[model samples]
Target: MCGIVAATAQRDVAPLLIAGLKALEYRGYDSAGLAVLDGGQIRRVRAKGKVREMEALYRADPFPGGTGIAHTRWATHGVPNEANAHPHVAGRVAIVHNGIIENYADLRARLQAGGRAFTSETDTEVIAALVDERLAAGLDLREAVLAVVRELEGAYAIAVIDRNAPGRVVGARRGAPLLVGLGIGENFLGSDAQALVQVTHRVIYLAEDDVVEITRESVRIHTLDGTPVERPVHESELSADAVERGEYRHYMQKEIFEQPRAVADTLEARLGPHGVLPNIFGAGGDELLAKVRGLHIVACGTSYHAGLVAKYWIEEYAHLPVGVEVASEYRYRDAVVPPDTLFVAISQSGETADTLAAMRESKRRGYLGTLAICNVPESSVVREADLRLMTRAGPEIGVASTKAFTTQLAALALLALQLAHQRGLDADRYAGLCAQLAHLPRAIEDALALEPAIVALAERFIPRQHALFLGRGVQYPVALEGALKLKEISYIHAEAYPAGELKHGPLALVDESMPVVAVAPGGPLLEKLKSNLQEVRARGGELIVFAEGEAGMDGNPARGALLRVASGGDFIAPAVFTVPLQLLAYHVAVLRGTDVDQPRNLAKSVTVE
Candidate 1:
């Protein structure tokens, strides 16, 4: 479940639908398709690969369809092929769906028993058949969707268009994200605001269990029980330029370079003469964070790595214990949570299925309050949270997530610093930490300056099949993030372990052929990390170290790739160190001719668990 775009407008919405699909391409899809109710009938076009292919197919012989729906599919229920591509049609109805229909197998059997043949193996097709069956029973489009959805179980967002009802689209979301874009003589539906940015800025964020029916002039929403409701129309801050790749070779590279500005945007208003303002999180935010005794940070992928780094910052600065967990695992198995613990959920999209579920579960598990550190303002996690701190990284169109990661660190750093001040930590030390954080934007800028060196390092990784990353203390999470970037974009197998853990078990795999990347930011653990690097050197492992220029690599022996970055001190070191690793991954992927922005087998947002 990845992306969906639905629109009914005065003009031909085929191009609009296709553009929306292309805009969501960063979410990673193996197939794409669109269905338009053209000329009093439904016409379908599906492609087995990128949206560009489908656009090419559509444009080869364009048609005037004033109403249409489209989707970019990240395969879950079936193989990646045209047959399984979205806009699944049954009878006169066509639909595009995101999220799992958990009871699809049973539904499919039930439908098959009724002698209805299925066209696709997707759970979505079963949904289409049910809706079609309801319509066949003389139910209207809205009633048909409501009846079918009531019989279904699991998280889902669906957009259905019927050939009999032109210039209208019916959408419902129970768990996944779906929204409506409002415009004169046009209205829109999208999984994310970015999808509708090209069409309109005004959007109505559909809440859980909300069903919406949109015509060219009006939008009517109802609950699954058919109770009428009204959703707020938010003027999205996302500009068309924010989602475009300008000057940079790819969105990933653009986002990597944008980190300096991104981090600055996140930290600017929050930090003042007094320190981090409590209001930056939300209104009355201080009440939520003030009495926190501990934190239970939950996230997935890159966000999880950020949480790992935050554990160190909070414990070091605020003198508070922190527990970090993978969101998917945390919700499934929980033992105990101490009193006065703040539940923190961090995500770029703020719509991660696991993280959202974990945060919801934590509410019942007794936490002080829930805070969402997210990039998207209108995302579900932010809306459902007791407090929210926006990263202000703008729109991160890259699937690999460069600016979003750094900006999240910047936000987390602010939280840690604010908590430190609240706890009456040393005045001078707190000020120093604030200064380091303020200098983070420039530090990230300096780090991006090392791209030429990272490019040279990238050449070394071109032929390598595997790599290793090492760090100590807070940098261990940076190491983990570095490993993730290399593996995700370059498709090289990479692993990260604390430098001290080399001898424990991981060192057995190190050899002359293995490239070991060491994140050697200047800190108290530098000496210990140096010793660990020597262990790799003695074993003939190719040593690649990213260190601060002040961290004397001249005296330290372990070497291969010694790249120096601007030192932001340990307080903001994680954000600075992340830049070069991101660039290295980008260049390495470019050299290998791999997709950098839309990495294979990965989506920009994990909407499905």
Candidate 2:
């Protein structure tokens, strides 16, 4: 989950590299470093902690050059320390890499046998050494990089600087993400387009195994095999404001409040007089949905939770069996493959490793077709899938997802309606669901209005050690998501169980000190869920319920505590209910004084498995 930013320009490139790294800090890194070719030598600085430390070091003693590469590393091969940080230099070459090199030990041994000295405990250093060795053998910077990449294995997106080639930076990618930003008389590279948005809005995303050579006045793209290639430069639609934190204390909070607008944006063009548009998922999607015998979803983390919610929607509306699995586990197992099952892959950043692999596996095993529900349009997952539904939530900066998840649910809701419509469900019923969807943005806004009350409730949870979330029917996934948010940001131990499953094991953990959160939407299952809450209450468990409509528990002492969030419809309740939980997590983390945006041991997009 490392971040890479490199630049070759007419002016000093260190400042631009620093700004790019700052833009990518939300991806979560443990260390930062930079390398610049100055005075025919690779000058480098590394810091074990935040980018600010690296910035301070650079301000004190800057490494100024026309070309440079920088990295914010989330450690994998070695500990997070100055020695283990990136921009690993060897001889005249400095390299910053993302993703692990699978055969580094063998490469390191070969290099050591060649009498090459290593200064850092990193596979990246081995890469630099190999490249330097190739350079020593009369290969130019581009050729050296290409030669070394052929000998390496596993995912990597690397930027290399050769002191011999003063004004150029060579970058190559395989499994990890890398893109080039186009600017007048300059060129840029970043692990994410966000890192380059401030400098240039035009970008070219590199395909796997594509190598790029960048200079102050020109850029050339080629395959790893040395054949020239061309890639389209698209004008990025993301504004600088989307990635900035304005009034909110953290990006997570800003994202939480952006859900209403996100959902509104996602619903655009998908709704009309015809209920749900048949072609919202792109061409031929309606026909595929009409023919599929079953549905299977593959995703990881928050996307998986979104899939869990989609399971209920698809099964209920489309009258088709739905199965959901964690993408990591799904790819490794010998699971049953149903014929004509519609495969769906969901991710906020289409670069999630496990999810992308699972999508490939599903496609290989012969599904009806694959659909990618993702936020970014040109992501790997969307590019490979047969049909695509872009969430259009824009850029999600926070590690803990908010707008992305809500927008994903909105997209899946559209899919569910399309399936129902094609399955010959009642026309009036479909139109009614569309009407409810039209009201979702406003309902999310109303739920956001309940933030103050949710914040007050969060203060009560600050000192608690554990929390249990409960819901029945479709709200079960909502409960799971709420628990995930609490545990992820606040560092509180939390678990979720279906209300009916309480007696199986979770009920035993209930006590006076434990707070039990219930997603009580007051549908047919409300009375049953109340009975489950009574079991918790009987055990002296403190109760917090996010109720929809009047559950008769308002101001009732038996309920312990209640917060009402606007329930647009049961179809849209997941999106509405998510607002308060996100608020609760934000407030609790703030109260606990934890890092709200970048949580410990987590990255925004899991690029490496």
Candidate 3:
């Protein structure tokens, strides 16, 4: 993923563009650059590193202009370096792009055959050069952009500016996020709302195949064929303070403690008296629920683990046969998704490349209907899905994801109950689960208070290079998510295995140096989980056992630390058990002095496949 920001203003736009880029840097920070029109020519400056490096470069030799485009790149086709940075220029035209061009090789060959020279090793530069070549053949800027788009393939959100057009900029998107911010005497364009939050909260989300022409005074929208179209501008609910870290030491920790509030917010509009679930999907949900032959849950990373947990809830409560697949691998497998099958795509950021692609594939094959459980409103997944369930986790900044994952589980559990209700499952059973769901936020609050013990354990084990996470039943996915958070931020080699699977092969890796974090809540799987923990202890692996209430094992206080989470029923236990693991990972990463917000080799959003 990469970040792009463009502005056309009556006054100097460099500072505004830079500030916007800084806000969007969480998307990508491999290299940053800006291109501005100066004295009838495109002037550019770029650097490979953090945004601060580029800011220093700009201050040293500024690009003077009232209109410009900027980018923070996460390199895809080229290595991260100054030369590979964005704002790739050709003649007097400059371009900054996010998303991949699948047919760049063929397009580049054609351009090279036409004697067009390239300055950088980027697919984006190809777009710039193609536009320049088209303009050289007497086509205007808009026509050239249209022609180049016709020749290009794959996903892209591109913003281009030409010195010839002066204070004008053009942008288009296909499979990536792009928004137009409306302001007085100026208009802005960026990959997301974060970039424009400082300027305005009024935004128009650009749809696929839509092109926008932005001028200093106004923004005009049109289809690829130059047909005028009306796009609705909505006021963003995002507050400037929402993006701040507040009193927390890091965004990760803030997000960890935000779980209780996030879960409560997600349940706000979906629940009523007596724990009744709202009909979010409308009457169509009834038809889809009735015709469903099977349920397929598709997602990636932490969302995938959430889906694994949903599979348990859906099958157990709704009595539906369920299949959980990683979104990236799901589309390629030979598994049959019949016409009556219901495909549920779970993604915190609805723009996740693999999950969106999987949704498209499911629709192409005529699945009954596709549903999206997403955090961001107006995201591509939410727009394309036949149904939507929005999570109110509000802007999870940490790359490892804390609040979003828990909120997704909360929403999905509600969905599972709603489906069970529609399926005519026993009313008392569904109501009991709903009552448990209502207490989850408070359970999470009690769970979060165990941070001191988790932090102490983290201090003891942060230097360790490897760890193992174990759980049984629904808690297994919590184990996976915990291991994922540790590995993602701490750069530790962590593995999550089902407690039953430990003796199969993972037992060989156990030792004194390896920490075994087991989810041993008092549930149906407690005895099996204890057996697994005993196996690890017998192998001399350090134990970090998370259980409910006071249940201490004998004579192993030093070698092992036990966290007694506030007791909850089995239905809500996963939500409670998740908090301490999140804390442990956050503390470990902090103790190791890792970049928790923008982890190495990762971006907040995965906009590319």
Top-lDDT structure, candidate number: 1
Q: Please give the lDDT score at residue 162 for candidate 3.
A: 85
TM-score of each: 0.98, 0.98, 0.97
lDDT of 2 by residue, 123-215 (tens): 899999999999999999999999999998888999999988988999999878899999998999999889998899999999989999998
Would you list the C-alpha lDDT of every candidate in the order shown?
0.90, 0.88, 0.87
Whose TM-score is higher: candidate 2's or candidate 3's? 2
**Model 1 worst lDDT run, 10 consecutive residues:** 550-559
TM-score: model 3 vs. ground truth = 0.97
In model 2, where do residues sit more than 4 Å from their true spots?
A: 549-559
**Clash pairs (backbone) in predicted model 2:** none
Off by over 4 Å in 1: 549-559
- What pairs collide in candidate 1? none
Overall local distance difference test of candidate 3: 0.87
lDDT of 3 by residue, 124-176 (tens): 88999988888888987777888888877889999999889988999988889
